[model samples]
Target: MPKHLNNQSSSVSLTVAAMGVVYGDIGTSPLYALRECFHESHGLPVTPDNVLGILSMIVWSLVLVVTVKYLLFVMKADNEGEGGMLALLALSQQSRPVDLRKGLNVVVTLGLIGVAFLYSDGIITPAISVLSAVEGLTLTTDVFTPYILPLTVALVALLFMIQRRGSGTIGSIFGPIMLLWFVTMALLGLHSLIQTPEVLRAANPLYAIQFLIRHAGVGILVLGSVFLVLTGA
Candidate 1:
């Protein structure tokens, strides 16, 4: 494959440093997503079809949003090296008429607010992931509970310490690690599928639509919780 456009020396350094800081949360997420998905909020083994449907939605969302929409299309719309909602808004404002410009600015400001919230979430995600993982020790034994904070602090400190070296040292390993991670996840999902093949039925959009329409009351109450599933990226 050709090198990324942002592959210059300084750019590469910055990317690695940024990845070192950003990837930990996502890298650790599979530790919980499948587990929680299978363990439904109700005391029933979640229908396998629903699990697969959700996974399918997640897979396609990544393909559409990350690969096609952002990488191929929106990234090409970059102004200089910047690309974000604000950048697009700025570009659009240049050509929009006065009447439309006022409406667009209101929309742009709201988009910017959401972008800022997501950015803040990204910055804090690592600490939250590490903290939650380390806190798991408490599940095994409350006697060890006192050590959780210290352990979390130590792990976070080490994570930050590696940022100085940048991600280059570990960069080579990431692709294989990600491959293994996905393969392992697929295996577990397949096992779940074997246990519950009926889940394959939810692949139809009708199931999701029907479920949402039928359970509007519960869905309304849990909309925020449902959205957390999409929060990792």
Candidate 2:
């Protein structure tokens, strides 16, 4: 291939690999996030209005927080081409003036705290996601209902077992796997939307605002559940 064609191919490959590795969690989260909002602990009703409200909140949260804030803004704040809380902290410290050194210690301390929370999240997110997925098997066979916990554990263990191969190897397959996953999800969502096209009205922000006003305490719980969709992002 020509040099330009080779460069283009490499970029496309990297983009696909990135999709598989980086987007796996966020992509799978939709399986459980909306359902969790109506869990007994949240006390949110399953009424049409409430559902619309929750859906609206989820839509806007992804648009504003993930697309606008993280993709557009935070991704630009990299340290040596790496991005994360620690990278942002290092970049900030480097760009600070000498006069600001007095408070640098405090900033570093806070950054460490954020990193600690991130570690905790990494441990919890996979467990929750796998468990939720395994739970879905119960709908197909009642036998799975009894084995849910064990199956979840085994699947998660196998997932971690493969991690030794390193991210580069995993990422190479992730793009195609995630692409198939998303396409399946989109088709399922479209099928449901066809049955109830009115649900599209949830795109309005007013539904979210009205839901918050009507539900008050329950709204908090719904928002908490909705926040899960953003996890691993």
Residues 1-233 of candidate 1 have per-residue lDDT tens digits of 34676467557665554454345345566554444444456332355444544554444445555678767888799656777767766665677533753455665667678679878876766676677678677777898688888888898788677656655655543434555666687898899889978766645556545544655655333333333344565
Model 2 error, position 194 (Å): 2.5
For residues 1-233, what per-residue lDDT tens digits would candidate 2 score against the true structure?
A: 99999999999999888888899989988888998988988766589998899999999989889999988998887888998998877777786633554555767778889899899989989999999998998887898788899989998898888777899877886788998898999999999999999999999999999999998977887898999998867
Model 1 C-alpha lDDT versus the unseen true structure: 0.59
Candidate 2 local Cα displacement, residue 35, angstroms: 1.0
TM-score for candidate 1, please give it.
0.60
After superposition on all CA atoms, what RMSD does each candidate show versus the true structure? 6.3, 2.7
lDDT measured at residue 55 in model 1 versus the true structure, 0 to 100: 53
Lowest lDDT 10-mer window, candidate 2?
95-104
Off by over 4 Å in 2: 1-8, 95-106
